[model samples]
Target: MNSRGFSRRDLLKAASSGFGYLAFAGLSSMAAGAGSKASPLAPKAPHFPARARRVIFLCMNGAPSHVDTFDYKPELSTADGKTSNRPGRIPGAKLMGSPWKFRQHGQSGLWASELFPEVAAHADELCVIRSMHTDLPAHPEAYLMLHTGNSQFIRPSLGAWTLYGLGTESDDLPGFISIKPTGRNGGAQNYGSAFLPAACQATRIGSEGQPIADSQIGNIRNTKLDAAAQRLQLDLVQSMNHDLLKRERVNPGVEGVIESYELAFRMQGKLPGVMELAGESPATKHLYGLDDPTTADFGRQCLLARRFVEAGVRFVELTHGDWDQHRGLKAGHSRNARAVDRPIAGLLTDLRTRGLLDDTLVIWGGEFGRTPHGQNADGRDHNNKGFSLWLAGGGVKPGITHGQTDDLGYEAVEDPMHIHDLHATVIHLLGLDHERLTYRYAGRDMRLTDVKGVVHKAILA
Candidate 1:
């Protein structure tokens, strides 16, 4: 204080009497020392009792045809060659029935098209939402709306919001992870944390067999320094930062950095054990289709997701790409479905066998659904008006279909569930009150479901 002629008074007053100082001391120890247990992602009890403790978000990059996949419209077949009076950009558009037939599968008598035989087998475990709608028709905007509740610009992704609301369940792994193929739309924006702390951001891993990164410490081999030596070096650095913090108030960026380093140090120790895939049996690998050339990569990703969530990661996201079927609907969708179907069924099976299904939520769908009317000769355009998504495990009422579209499958005719409503339901399942869980940003308190959202309680078990 003498060198700069400044006392602690120059800084912003601590929020609590001495709690701020105690927090600072803890932060300091974390920055310079190793083995710090203070990860923001560390699991903690929710604000209330939660029905689900984890979530697996299977995002189909391009929208899929709900009529062809899950929503069996018998009338669509009869009206296949006829024009429709449905309200849309393409008025009086010709109806397009699915090329495949539908059959009731499982004891639930759920109508599923031939495209998803594997998923159809698990019909009793699914709560199919046929009334999901969104605000945008374009890919990026729809994606933003689905993930962040806003189509305007950057905001905290759903994963980040979940992390902020619930923290982490495992100190070793990130609370949220994004599993992606090589080239995909929306890029990192789909998983980025715009304003929340960086720790809330998704830790992405490639579907092409790459580690998240070389997580080893930068200078792990350079210095022969022992643990005691490392502690001293960290202490010196912390002292310098504390002095600087005394001079400058409201140092969120600095504080965030300190917290990040501590979390990284903790991760470095426990990550290796988590990455070992050899521990899995050969039968389990084959169940996920890991040996099939077409499904191998995506299957591996799904397997890893199961592994991560089993280890207590709060959320895990997996994406399989190129569903933008502007043409060649048959080939495009078949390939996409082939890549994911068996692996997804296997994931549910494995989770159930491990007794994790009841506590883990599994969600599968795209940003939106494809139009029932053909955009080109063979393909459908974006239809945000209504689509289908499925949820399994957690507290979802299994073996049930929740909503329906009109006879032509053009509009949501019953029990409309908006994207915001879906978000609200997810938060509710996790024991979070969507309206009350808010963060102050840009002079307003922002939430996942900004000003609108209604949890669909009827779908809950």
Candidate 2:
């Protein structure tokens, strides 16, 4: 202040407008660091020996059909056009067979349909879970269930919980990031901290359907003050924030603000560079299918995910919606698969070559699986009974298919993994005990599993 010939109040009064956005991010980040000396985002040791150091969820929004994709139901194909003998809903629905042909891929000989030929090339790396179920078939509730483990009540998301447990590896980036998030179904709650400390919340880059190149963190840039000037202004504001914290004793809002300010300051320079894909080699671009228009958007997202993880961001979720495929199952599913197939395969290969795959858990699936029975001309209704999701790397047994659906692929007949089990297993892979990772809230101890979760030990390596 003396050197600049400005008092604390002078700088704040001059820069108050520019600093308002920082507080907003701070509130949203819900970061820890309030009421404590150490950063809530500071990296910490895992509870026990760890299998995975980080997580990347490739969320295929709008339920994808199990029978057409990973769950090869030959029986359904043979019985195509037969009435759905299975049960209560959809009285006269008929069974549908995949138009796409399924074939064995890799040495594992796991079956993958023609729609995802590129992903099938890496079949040996996948641990396909054929028997998966959730509580509901509706998008909103099921989406919430997948991300937060509970749809009825508010809760911290898996990403938020992970950040709370392990903290972030990067001080320059958010601990958890959701790129191209659709922000629908559950919207912010999908990555929200709920009752957890605000520090654990995610930093969103762009929303779903938005082009990655056009996406930017709003208000991160300040035209009024240069770097040096911003620093002075930030210090003054932070001092006020800390003072408020001292007075209040426990202020999560203030803590989040402080942390967010610091992070916003640090990341302003770094994040821009990360978003620029021009630095990547042409070969790298091709590998991610960035050269093609059909794949460019999702490819860009996948590339960003790789970049963010390499920079030490803890959790990154990649969203690819439009998987619902209710009616035009053939056209819709084909296009969706074509867009992401090569990029995903390339990501797995890139991670392996870089040695990230060994300790980085890669998850791929939608909210739930679609019904085996056909809906209209080519559509499939939502089915919460049986589905499939595949896990790769992060200490999962390679080249194996876990569990199974019934002959018609309508119900999970063996080793059925509920949403809670998936959450528990995911946490387990990251070296946190699902039961032990609890946050006390609302007069009871709360957890991601919400009192019902059994880790799928059979899938573990």
Best by TM-score: 2
lDDT of each: 0.76, 0.86
**In model 1, where do residues sit more than 4 Å from their true spots?**
1-42, 89-92, 181-185, 207-249
Worst 10 residues of 1 by lDDT: 20-29
Global fold similarity of model 2 (TM-score): 0.95
Q: What tens-digit string does per-residue lDDT give for candidate 1 at 165-276?
A: 8987775566787776324445666777777766677776654234333222232221344443333334444445555655674465555555554444455455556756
Candidate 2, position 214, lDDT = 89
Q: Looking at model 2, which ten-residue stretch has the lowest summed lDDT?
A: 24-33
**Which residue pairs come into collision in candidate 1?**
32-234, 41-168, 42-168, 43-168
